[model samples]
Target: MTSDADPRFLRSREAILNAARELLLESGPTAVTHVQVAERAGVGRATVYRHWPQAEPLLVEAMATVPMPFLDKPTVPTREWLRRELTAIARQLDLDDVRAVSTTLANTALWDEDMDARRAQFAGILTTRLAAALDDAQARGEITLALASQDAAAMTIGPMYYRSTIERAPADPALIDAAVNALGTWAAG
Candidate 1:
């Protein structure tokens, strides 16, 4: 067994992960088997299986490497922030790769405990960012949320996911505008 501190081990791991990610983007999650990843990584099948015993966790980890749209920019007014957040979500969901990976994550997570935990962790990060924005707005006295920021985030984000992934339709400008307007009304009320 190679030590984790070994440079070769790290390089091999990185290569395997990158290969898995490429497979996911090129052919979707169904293509990300141990043999396929090993072949793509130029490593042995044992190496891939040794590192990730299950295909689901490996796929989830690869998807985690994806760069998600974030609310990391400078803070803006609440309304502006909400609009920008929704717009970002719509744009990300519009991507074929993101949609495919997202659907895979949602589906595999149902049967894999590790994947489910990873999925929850990913979702928590997004929800926390959104909640922070809502909390900031409340602090500024811009809007009063009738529900918690987490709940507000669900209201704002759930529809975009549904429209893009479930409906297999673009998250149109009208939908974004309506989500923004509806959230504003709910918060104001």
Candidate 2:
């Protein structure tokens, strides 16, 4: 029997995860079934079951492997920096695979406790950055936000999220500008 730490075992695990992620990105959450993953990975169904007995956990792990984009630290004015970051986020959300996996995460989280935590954790990738940026801007005396950084992150990104994930539409550029302007105004108060 191959030990867990064996190189072959690790390679197989990586293959399984890559296959599951491919299916999720290509055909959404339903395509991540053990049979599909096993077939795609060229592994036995029993192998997939051995790693993740539940499809939800399997799906979550696969989704986790999909990278969240990050921009370098701000080198421009905070508002400009925020625009660039938000624009990057909008562009990311515009991808078909991103929209599929994101919706899958949100919908699945409604029913699965583990998935819910994962969803929040995944979402923090953006919000945490947003919060940090806002805090940094405040420290620089560039803007004063009455709301907490976390709340501000949500407020700014919520529209983009809704457009891409909920409405199944691209995030409009105008919406991005509007969000930035609105946040700036809110922070100015």
Clashing pairs in 1: none
Inter-residue clash pairs, candidate 2: none
Off by over 4 Å in 1: 1-11, 18-59, 63-68, 185-189
Model 2 quality (TM-score): 0.67
lDDT of 1 by residue, 46-149 (tens): 99987888676677788788654465552656777777878887887787656766787788889978778888978888888878877887777777666777
Give each model's whole-structure lDDT.
Answer: 0.78, 0.78
Candidate 1: residue 106 lDDT (0-100): 86
Q: Candidate 1 — worst ten consecutive residues by lDDT sum?
A: 180-189
| Predicted structure 2: lDDT | 0.78
**Lowest lDDT block of 10, candidate 2:** 180-189
